[model samples]
Target: MGLSKRRAHLRKAWFKKGCVSPKKGQTVAFPTVADNEFVRFEKKSFDRRVHTSNNVLTFKDTDGTDTTVSALRPRPNASNVVDEYSGCGDESLYPDLCTNKLMVQAKVQALFYSSFKEHRQDKPNCEGDLNFDAAYSIKWGLGWRELLKCTKCSCMCDYHNLYEEVENKKRSG
Candidate 1:
């Protein structure tokens, strides 16, 4: 877990730059082409090390007109990866995910049931029927979300953002 977290921090730092290596109380080391030491137009050149003080990657080059450098959307495979996105973590940890409009609401709803139980479960929900309800909270702007509806008490559990919407939909629909 710490490995993943460290990797996440490193990735974020890598993109923003200004990172000094941990050894030098900085970040990382990137090899750079010494443009100032060029012998001729296409003759000789020198190599140097540049601090990752800017967003551009010193070691990378693009063949096109794009001078700026950025991380590709699809990341490479990693032995350890961290979920660093603000709203893109486990539901149990970050329940207030609705604020980030970019986060996707639809996913494997199985993990959320325990979260539902953790926050909204009452003492009398032993006979609750836990299942995924596709259209339960759509009109509330939550998009497709799961519901933990207790058949015994008719009490429902959902995302914090969907509480009012789910209730209103139940009443009107």
Candidate 2:
């Protein structure tokens, strides 16, 4: 299949930023995020030059308003995006999700779903942090160890490799 739905959405969003051909060793700001964020595209190496991966994306924070940028919710085709102040439901008391930490969490959650896929699958009826439950974790065969590993590499290779392995096993079986 072509890129998965989420992956395609990310690519479309990235491309909409007018990233036609990012020069080598050049830094470009992702238009989806605020102007301070910088993403450095990788240089094409020797043999596998066709496949270049951008591994360095940096966020530059300035002290003032606009400390955080809101992600585009209700993904273009998504029908279930809720109107919540904060996904963690702490906004009523905390009231400050614009902090750097929460910004990072939101970005990570948006870009990497492999780590949260099990939770999302288990709690399809719920939104935000409520999707993560002990019962769902147990039913999905995920625990602290698996969670740790997923968090470590879900944005990169671990999840893809595991998916491929499972696909291969299914095909062979």
Candidate 3:
């Protein structure tokens, strides 16, 4: 039978057998539900909803490669709002955003001083790795990778460049 028809039959059978509302002091046998199938269905539905949303931002470079930048990552704090730094004169902006401005300046120093490789093979991913590199650079001295500004988009996508470089190499090979 079709899935919908089977589900309807199961629903009717469940209702008929009092699975929906058990009698007083009586045990009810419920119809079996596949957890994996249910989870897969839910994930598919959620993915559809996310992809259809207006909040999703996509960027296409001059090379015609589509890059999607969707979803704002929340701060480590419990609150939905990102953490702000009062020191930046404009208290409204997140500290991390303010830090990027400093990073832009520091990149000039790195260009002359740092011996970090021009192309990094191990491109960083995950919040921990990204944050860890950013965090440690202040105390541990300047690293090789400088936050390179994209001439096309004018966005400070340091990691994005690394990933793109790796992808280009793979395609050429």
Best by lDDT: 1
Per-candidate TM vs. native?
Answer: 0.23, 0.16, 0.17
Model 1 segments beyond 4 Å from truth?
A: 1-106, 109-111, 119-121, 139-143, 160-173
Q: Candidate 1 residues 1-173, lDDT tens each? A: 25688788888777345755556656777998654431211111111221144664342233324222332332333333333443544664334433443223434333364645553536543655544343354434544344545555565665433332334445554
| lDDT digits (tens) for residues 90-123 of candidate 2 | 5443332322221234433543576456545644
Task: Report the poorest 10 consecutive residues by lDDT, candidate 3.
Answer: 124-133
- lDDT of each residue in 28-82, candidate 3, tens digit only: 7999854422121233333333343388533333354653423332223333334
Residue 133 of model 3, lDDT score: 32
CA RMSD (A), model 1: 26.2
State residue 26's C-alpha deviation in candidate 3, in Å: 13
> Where's the lowest-lDDT run of ten residues in candidate 2?
156-165
Better candidate by TM-score, 1 or 3: 1
Higher-lDDT candidate of 2 and 3: 3
lDDT of 3 at 67: 34
**Which residue pairs collide in model 2, if any?**
none
Question: How many Å off is the CA of 113 in candidate 1?
Answer: 3.4
Model 3 clash pairs are 116-144
